[model samples]
Target: MKRKISTLLTFLILSLLIIPSSLAHDDQAKHDADLMCVFWGDDKVSLSSEEKIAFKIIANAAAITIDQYSLNPNGRIKEGTFNEIQEGLKYFGLPELSINFNDIDLNIKVSNDGKNISPNTHRLYTHLGWNYKKHPNNDFWKKRKHVLIDSVNRLLFNSKKIFSWFPWASDVVYPPSEQCDAFCAIIYYVHIIGDHIAGDTADKLKNIEPLIHYTSMDTPGIIVELKEQLQIVFQEQKNSYTFFELDQKLSDLTISIEKNCDILGFIDTAEKCKKNQEHAEQLLQILSKHLPTLLKNESFFKSRFK
Candidate 1:
């Protein structure tokens, strides 16, 4: 009887141990499956190390500018547009201008002048494009776009040129701009780029040659990753109700690029700065819509470090 009791006790203990171990193993397996499911559906595809880093930098700047624009709209100046020049200064941590143009003391003596308008003030007003009496011309808008594009293009190119000239000169300028009111324009560019380009064109912009390139060149590998991600996304939703919506977004970008570049006709209104910005934005939007698929690609996660 004692021997029988001993055998029964041992069997009960073993069964308890085995059951818990099996349950634990099953739980772990379920957890891993859940992780894989999310990984395949939520992440963007992998980017090359170089492209990843550059994209991060540009993306960070673009995000900040976009967020600020959404919140403040016409930041600083209440009229006209946001100044991109100022945004660049702020991005680089520069101090704000202490002297307001209205408050500045312009010591001018009027000597029998029929027009009492001082030359300095007149010039300042004209340059600021605040004169409502002047006929609205394309020159002012083009000039504003020109100044802003130069500032952004310089910021992007300056890093490469300086590094090429002197590898030791690696002080990357933050919020780089050439004008005091440049931030507004910078914000506008970021907004447009994010809206139109899908943010992937940043990859192509990096390969451009000297003096002609508008932004830094990123690795082509990154483009591959983006294209792969976009493909997966488009394929997954090719027949969905939202496919039409995504196609419309792509169409909008195409239209914007064509208009900015004057691809439809011989429009003399094509300015490189404006067109470049429009191009950048268009690329951003195109890439953005497919970001979910890229980020979630199973292969992307598996090969992220590789």
Candidate 2:
């Protein structure tokens, strides 16, 4: 009986030690999966310049609508605000959004003195642990406020259409007839930027710096290196390289960066390195598939880098 009790206690101790580690692994895996979904969604969508401008206009209008509602004592979007969105949608020939101002119940309130208020559209502020009264005009809040506005625009205008379940299929399908708009692009952009910004200042800079360098035309670093590499690979192969070979070369470059580059200094753990590798692989595949066409538009392609 004494031996059995001792064994039982040992087993319990072992379980306690193992369970949290297993749970932590599971949590990390889920987080990576969510990130991958965002990445994949962004990669598959393409938007034209005009559509991009229209989306911006519509997004700005939506922000105005939210601000108007927040300021209104009645907690309703103004008729003018609603009309502006409709007009923008019609002008762009985009499908009409089905929101009624009367139907929205955002559960916000204003103080009697008009100085204090319940949280309105910027719920992300609360999520980030930012006290509105304390950090109202800081750069951190401003950047995140833009993200919130874009998210709200997506929620009001595009989410229902994009996320609606297909009648014949169990899964949600973005309608094929509709163009992939700002909604598709912004979701992942927001997720990645939001995730980076959630970290400490140093870590945030480390994470976002690579992204900024890759996206900005004025920044002469990773993107320029990528473009040069792409040119070299295409020139050497003369359009004869197998997709597999091209993918492998690009993967090698990214892996090299992952292992040795200071650009990814924020990736401290093996799990983060693995996740970054996977994201790089996906991006490389996109470049590989579009290599021929992208090369053909040499001037346009070169314009994307320094």
Error of 2 at 23 (Å): 31
Once fitted onto the true fold, the runs of candidate 2 whose alpha carbons sit more than 4 angstroms away are: 1-52, 55-86, 99-200, 203-250, 261-306
Q: Candidate 1's residue-wise lDDT over 1-306, tens digit each?
A: 665455344433432331111111132222222222222322354556433332323323222222211112122211111222323323333322222222221122211232333322222222222112331233333333333333334334343443322312322433233321332232333233322222122322221211111122321222222233334434544555444554566556555545543432221233443455455444444444543343343232223223
lDDT of 2 by residue, 23-97 (tens): 111322232233333323333335454443343333333333222333344644333444444444443333334
How accurate locally, in lDDT, is each candidate?
Answer: 0.31, 0.36
Q: For model 2, what is the error of residue 14's alpha carbon versus the real structure, in angstroms, after optimal superposition?
A: 61
In TM-score terms, candidate 1 sits at: 0.24
The root-mean-square deviation over C-alpha atoms between each candidate and the true structure, in angstroms, is 23.5, 22.8
